[model samples]
Target: MTASPPPADDLSPPPSCPDAAAPAPAQALQRLKVAPAEQPLSAAQKKFNRLLARVNSLERQLEQLQQSADALRAPHLQRMDALRQRMAQAQRAMAQLLHARLQRPGLTAAQQRAVRALLRDLVHAVPPSPQPEPEWAALRAAYPRPVPAAPSPEALQQLLDVLSAASGETLELSDLEDAGSPEALIEALAERLHAQDEARRAAAAERRARRKTTARQAEAQAQAQDARSALRGIYRQLASSLHPDREPDPAERERKHALMSQANTAHERGDLLALLRLQLAAEQVDEAAMARLGDARLQSLCLLLQRQVGTLDRELAEAEARLAHELGVQVRAADPRRLLEADLQALQDELQNLAEGMEHDVHALQDDDKALKAWLREQARLAREHERAAREMTGFGFQF
Candidate 1:
């Protein structure tokens, strides 16, 4: 016996061909006399198609929900990410101004320490360092003679090798070989180590990137395979019920031939729902017959339906979660566009406030710097006068 037609729901107009042109209705009915009577669908087949339709409908609904959620989430995610970047920039700029203010000369050690402590507190509260240029410079200047870490064994050995090579006064490989002092040798070794470390890091990152790409490709292939499997199952069911070669009546054969062509096209395109609907249209299954199906077949149909429902449920849940994360709220079935607009407005307001604050802090720091310079100049003038007076008193030979 031929396999039964696949379950149906995805409906589309079958493309027309020359063979699709129908004869007169009277002539077609007469042609049916010589053909075998059309068989009524069994109770099992009808029930299976009905359950399949329900499953397909649920799947379609879930797909639409996911698409809608993604559509709503994409812009909001991009906007939020952009706002985060801008906020970080503003915070970093403010930190730089604070750091620069603390850098002015002539403050007492305690006063300098207090200012630095305040800066640290503020930075710790909302740290944002795009490049850390200002912060690193301040650190370096504060500890110009910071205790140096001892050279590694490899570095020491490399230094020794360099010294041995340079021991022959006439031999010189490069300017680096001429490094005679301990500091010079250490610097050369440090440079070499740094370059090697950078190279290793680059190689490691490249390998990780390759692995990620391979994983993504494998995931895509798996999804494609699953789609093909689903379409194949649906196609098999459709072919069993609608094979034109099985229809002996010329008129019925012509009609089945057209439907079979449509089925083939839908299967090729991986349109499972279309195949299901086509089978339903051909009267391969119906509602009343579904109610009379055997227990075994009904149970099998139930299992397929349950599987479809589970798949759709998982997909829907993932889409909902993604949307909620993007919006920073537990969104349900509400209109997402409106909610995202509200979030966008709040973010814009925050961005504006941060920009104004950054600008004000920058101006204040510049003014403070000018005042600091003036104070230092006045102190210098006072010292010069005191020195002149001391010289004059000494020259006058006044003994007190």
Candidate 2:
């Protein structure tokens, strides 16, 4: 077969390869050049930097608060589990007691009714087993059928109102009717009580605010306002400094764009530290002049710092209160790591005691049951003997 001729373009000479070690393009080199000499940071900029440091410190405080919250959460959850287990143990103990009481043979109809009434009195009694055996029949007769229906919204609201009145706290009226069981209703009522307590505290704060402010309080309020103004001024300065649209060079514009985005985010989040860091990185602030802030600006910064610290403290307090509420315990100076251990131990101890009591009760019940059975057998034997004696007497035709 004849080989096809090569294409015209394929015959052209290939281009020579450059040295692997060649320097980058001039444009890239220009891009890599160091930025222009830094300008001195203005008085306002220095104040901003100081405020940013305070903000960063506050952020760290918040982080530590969150960590404490997490630490508290684990123990609180363990305590809750312990409580649940305790409840289950209590239920099991009660069940065993009921089973023991119900196991007595030869119970009359009236006696069975009385056992059932006792079982019915227990609100959280367990359901009976479904076997046709005699032992199970007694238990089955005693187990109550508490097939609960969902409460109507109006009735739920009424119940919530009553609970709220009894608790002396505002109860939230939301989806409470969906509490499908009585136990769930109780839990919902508990949550509402907690919410109400928080609401009442807020109201009390409002009431306290109605009181005349002392001179010190007035001065502090003014300082707080000044701190807020200073923060706003610093944020505006950062925003103006990093306006990307004003940058003439594309590379500088790109850099400004990123910085501006960061500034915007920091402003939105009130993150003074991030904005200050961006300014420092961009060489917009003069480090040497950062310490040259005026006395007035320094005072303002101090006020800002005070306000920030107070805010952090308040947040931490709220977190602690929330944790305390979840654990159903007062957390006054309590270590977050070990807060729930005591409660859990107490509950476990209670459970142990309950279990022991139940065991004792079960043994006593079994002994009583054995005695009852023996007595019933004896009574039955006596009845049979009496019948046989009567039959012999009747066959002999003897008149009494």
Candidate 3:
């Protein structure tokens, strides 16, 4: 009997890879292939890919959130989150558009409205620009309770008016809550308002984060400018003094010229660390020439930095010495600056207390051991004396 392979219709579609945005069409049609179906893919595979794109889009949004310093607004966090959910729903709608995967045909109509609502919220959160005077006046007037909130009719109407204010657009409202009904304009408008609120919050957070970043960058740039200005002065002074033109010997002058060139290059390149090394190497340069180039300002800056460095170094050395003495062990210098009083002070204090406790314990143990030794010796002496007395009493055979 010839056994036939089981029909391909019995096989289920393979699980889609999450990372794959587009899978091979050949693999997708295997289940339906039993019927001589010529289509390369089935509806399931398309649906999965659309879902992946939606999720990937959401992740990009989260990444944007992380790169920002300002998070959700306090007054509208919950509202914003709800707005985000709507946006996710909107993304689902987008996936449906790609895959044509909606289970219910009527659901598509409602989903589309929801998508618009989400967009409305996003728009409110991050408007293209500030509102016109009349629009702002309307918005401010509509949300009357000294604050704005959901179900604020004035606010809602005002928002509608703002949207309408754009050239030649008519926005209508129906009073029902069912998004499925095109006639239910109020539900659609309310949904849009919620989305707008979320969008507004997201925009506000983004603006705050942008301001903070700009401020920080500005501060760093200012400090860098100050440092470069100071370093350039030092380099110029050193260069003028060491220039080969001042050298008496031609051979020596050429070497000095090379060093001066290196110094100038180092200064231009903002290589402070290299400049320090060059300063050490420039010891052979003429002393009189070097001194003539010195500036009071440059000297002042150097002295200030040196004084601070010296202070910190001395403090660190004292800390290291104390730590070494307490440990009763040679602790190698782990740092060039040694230990400052502020660095690890809490841990050092705890270590000091622990070391003191250990010493006390050692003294107690020594005292206890000495007392035990003395007691043992006394007991032995008494035992020997008793043995001697008994021997004297029993010595009648050798009586002398």
Candidate 4:
């Protein structure tokens, strides 16, 4: 076979070794694959690094959160701040409403009195707090608070107008309803009576609970006092036994000295329970109360708190009085304390009136009930007499 000359290459240079410059198509493909293979791995490494960074950030956040939670474990000023804020908000709203009402000219002085009366009535209906303040504070800590409803736009405007008219001017009214109208009076009396009854019941219940708490505290205090008295007796006995002066021996003197020191320390520290335990170990019992008079921690704390409250109350009162003096002529205007006192006075009056009205109502109801019972008894007696008469007529064989 004739060997044909090799066909001339067209439109391209001769293929070069991939190691030099140009590469075969297969080698080029392999090179491209190598870079992509590295790319996927690099992407995975980047993702892993991001994941590690996120984990580290979360760890830091968790540690911070733990520290914050631990900080909240103690009672904090923030709680007091929040309470004061809420109280301030309520006060501001009340002051604004009053100011607005005072600005309105159309409202009469009596209508204003009536408005105060309504506010007075409503404030009393908030119910008396029977529990201790600390207990109430604790309950408030856990309990969900009620959200106040927003007033309707029209009602808000009306309130604003009424408040504006009420400021600085006197109110006057006419067409007063007759106080002697039985139906109207009865309805009013009934409502007042019911409210009064509730208040009395509340007061009585409070008095009872307070008595129980006081009794418990008193008993606990008595026990502690007795323990302390015993401690003194024990101390006297121990001191007699451990007197360093009585010990002629040097080492025994040192030992007695130590015991005496311990006894003194314990007595001064008021470790009555420990002292009592020591007394029991001594195999001789003394009348705890007869041993000596002493103090109780619970009673002491109660006294301390009472004194603190009294002092704080005096300070607050003085501050308020000074403020009032400064605003003497305008004390009623913008006096937070005066408003608080007025509110309190109004509530007391309402509660007293309601209680009296209820008592009267209850008495009246009881009287009516007694009258009805008497009438029933009379009717019953008449029926019996008629039956006897019928029986007597039958026995006499007479037809009427």
Q: lDDT tens digits, residues 38-148, model 3?
A: 544234334323333333333333333322212312323344344444444443333223223223243346444443433333234322235365643443243233233
How well does each candidate superpose onto the true structure, as a TM-score?
A: 0.40, 0.42, 0.19, 0.19
Model 1: residues with Cα > 4 Å off, grouped in runs: 1-61, 105-235, 240-275, 281-283, 322-400
Q: Relative to the unseen true structure, what is the C-alpha lDDT of residue 207 in candidate 3, on a scale of 0 to 100?
A: 88
Residues 109-205 of candidate 2 have per-residue lDDT tens digits of 6555654554554424433335455644454455756567877878777887887788765665544436765468678778877888899999999
Q: How does candidate 1 score on lDDT?
A: 0.57
Q: Choose 1 or 3, whichever is better by TM-score.
A: 1
Report the lDDT tens digits of candidate 4 across residue range 204-235: 99997777467778886676565455456657
Q: How do the candidates rank by TM-score, highest first?
A: 2, 1, 3, 4
* Model 3 ranges off by over 4 Å: 1-219, 284-400
Given candidate 4, what's the lDDT at residue 337? 42
What are the lDDT scores of the predictions, listed in order?
0.57, 0.56, 0.43, 0.43
lDDT of 1 by residue, 1-400 (tens): 9965433332222323223233332332232111222656555455555655555556555565566566756776676677666665665565566567666675666556545554554455453356667754564355334356877757766766776565532323354447765678557766766788899999998987777567777765565565455456557666776678877789878787888898898766544445545545654433333344444544444444555567666666776687667667665443455665566567667776766765555555564756544544554576689888888888899533
- Total clashing pairs in model 1: 11
Residue 296 deviation, candidate 1, in Å? 3.3
